[model samples]
Target chain A: MRNSSLIPFRSGGGILMALIVAAMAFLACFALAGALGASKLAGAWTDGLSGAATVRIGAEEGAPEQQLDIVLDILKSTEGVIDAVPLTEDEVAALLEPWFGAAPELSDLPAPAIVAVTIDSANEPDTSIVQARLDGAATGAVYDDHGEWRGRAASAAHAVRSVALGALIVCALAIAAVVILSVRSGLSAQSANIATLRLAGAEDRYVAGLYQTRYFWLGLIGGIVGCILALGAMVSFDALSTVSRALPSLDLSGYWWFLLLGVVVFAVLVCVLAARITVLGTLRRGA
Target chain B: MILFENVGFRYGRGPDVLQGLSFDVPDGAFTFITGASGAGKSSLLRLLYLDDLPSAGKISLFGRDISTLTRDEIAWFRRRIGVVFQDFRLLDHLTAAENVALPLRVAGAREVEYRDNVAEMLQWVGLGGQMHIRPPQLSGGEKQRVAIARAVVASPDIILADEPTGSVDPEMAERIMQLFMEMNRLGKTVVFATHDADLVKRSKKPTIDLKSGTSSGGVAA
Candidate 1:
């Protein structure tokens, strides 16, 4: 606290550094949000589809009604099948209502018969065996356990998360670089002051502490401002469009305090570390 | 308290500034190093302060060989020796009291413990009323007094001054020399480097005259 008077209370470069930290923190928060959102979406999709599958019966081979009955019977007898229900024609039409516009012409279309199958967690049935049995019992029958689509969704989410992580890393590096440059400039400006301190028998830590404490507070203030701004922007954007609504709701209200605390702590640490290294390096070289 | 054996020094790749310099100053002695400008008087004092190491000779202080001391140990040694520069070198932003309290602060002393001592030192040097003023607001003589107060406030064992009276008038110069003499009388070794032959002759203290780099003659009393 005594050395606080040795350094100027206000530096233009310090202000600039704080603003840069704020911007970086803002971008970092958004990147983290993107990563979290992607992870949540992937989890939701996996949870919705993990225990269910669908079967399609073609009308080209035998009578569609007969093929449906045969496929339903086979699914019911399977050990892992919890329930297998064949879809009525009216239900199939309702499923296609969104695309067909509820027109009477939808009834004339050669839509295949569909059966919904739920599997028990204790006994997972092999879909390949199920499809083979269906083919033998009723030609042109197909089984779909949704594995391919789930894998693709997982891979897409992973790629998005990776990009978000890459963005966060880039923001961190930029923040550190800004802090280093700011501290270096301040040191160069105060070289004479530093010499006076050194001649007074002050150690390297003493001099470096002056700058680190200043930058640490600046970083904390900037980080808080940035986090608030980012959250505000998210809320505004979510209100303006339906895209964010379609994704899983973040509900940051329950955990925002912790997130803000994390951002402030991280920012302060980066600033202090950058300033310490810069000051120590300069002093060592001068020595 | 100080010894040098055939000390030699030079800037990087430059010719020798001081060579084959050998001398010793007894404890509690008042010594003056007199020379023309650039005759290496400041450079010699710098060696004693460990600011610059001897290039080709050995130097010892307080009975410990300086060449063997680590950087931290050298800093500790420096804390015991006070240095006064010609430029005053007071931080322009700090008040006189703050400037005088710098050494104690650097040593990590609590402010409440040293506040009264700093104020008493300032008053002793005749700057009691100007303690709250910054360096830029003080006169040149007053600044020099503040610098002297700062140098001696920590009660360092040795005080090294480089041209302490170079910028002040004759009356003020004598007053400043009286301060250093008073400190010397109190058992602190004082080594002053100056080009003022008149002041040197008036004091009649032991003087080391340097002409090029080597000592001109043995210590002249």
Candidate 2:
């Protein structure tokens, strides 16, 4: 009745509890967004390798060096082959060292050239024709189209994305629950105030509106703060550059309105949840 | 006007505090309800203020059946009735002026519009110098006076007070009673529950007597 405090929005323990829920809602959303970013980063790797393919050719070393030259000639004359580069002996050795020990126990190691082929989409070659011509014993050339591997990798990435998105939804529901619980507790604490309000001719809506607006602002302020902290963390990690793996970057440049809308809607929803619980609980008190 | 017909209440497994009670408070009349401790006097006041619903029978406020009204509708009807509790129940965070203006504020009247009225009401309750003081800082009598100011500030259709003068001295009690009288004289129906027989005799209002959980006198008038 007589509040001397300037920031006079105290509704006892209830409002404080509501604020706590609001903060939790914001943090939950923050965690959800982080998971989303992580999943997106994982998915970006497939996009990076979209336009590349590798061909591995295995041949006997005892066979004359003429076979290697023949394969190279055919690759050059091929319509879809924009360029073909064969790996040197040392380059092949370096690539195999990670998989096997570098020293060879036996001599005459039959090492075949690995060719990277780039196709000109304007004159795409028929893979079947290329494979049929190059699969002979002299060449032993194998076209290892990366599309199937890329597809599997993309599927894994999408799986991660789905799991992360699901986690985000659970977090949002957790936030909603916290909002409801906090509001109910807050209403309980202010039972006297509510009774006073009711007797003073303030309807349920008026009482609920007070809590709704208060929690809405709380969620908005907390959500924006969480988003800013998330962005700062992103920039900080990128600055470190220790993880060259591209972390999922938020496309925030043109999406400010979306973020604003998210903050507003998030705040409103949390507030509405809190207000609904409080109003219903108070009304049930038989006041 | 307010009326209760065959009203009864039992707070879930507890014995009935009010039972088979019937009373009508006429429009714009000042009345006193007197009883001993736990005599259901406060319970009766609770019914009029819409704080407790009748467990049975009917309660009429402004000629509408309160028993059938929704909580929202009851709240709306209650806005026209002001209540002062024994505990004063002033929101501890609000200033005296704000507390007094609470009724007007709840009614959605602009502060600019209600400023003069609230100021006059505070002055009438003899709390002019303490408008800025919080409830906790005020003395018992001062708090009681502030509560009285809040009750009548909105010029409500009815004012229900439960032992409003219970904590004040005789002199202060008389002052608070006079304020209620003035409000009633100005056309607001007034019902005050009190143990202070002296205050009741001094005001000379028609009295409703309750004893041992039952009305000792005739139906409320």
Best by TM-score: 1
Location of the lowest summed lDDT over 10 successive residues in candidate 2 chain B? B212-221
Q: Relative to the unseen true structure, what is the C-alpha lDDT of residue A85 in candidate 2, on a scale of 0 to 100? A: 78
Off by over 4 Å in 1: A1-4, A61-81, A101-110, A120-139, A242-252, B62-71, B198-205, B216-221
lDDT tens digits by residue: candidate 1, B69-95: 765677778789988888889999899
| lDDT score for residue A55 of model 1 | 92
What TM-score is obtained for chain B in each of the predicted models?
0.96, 0.94
Worst 10 residues of 1 chain B by lDDT: B212-221
Model 2 TM-score relative to the real fold? 0.73
Tens-digit lDDT track of model 2 for A1-287: 33232223555644454455455545554555555555566567656654455667665544535666767777788777888877777887788778666867412576666887777655667777777777664456677656677678767767766776676566566666666766666667677877777777787777777777766666665556655555565456556554554554454444544644564476557657756676667666654
Candidate 2 displacement at residue A229 in angstroms: 3.1
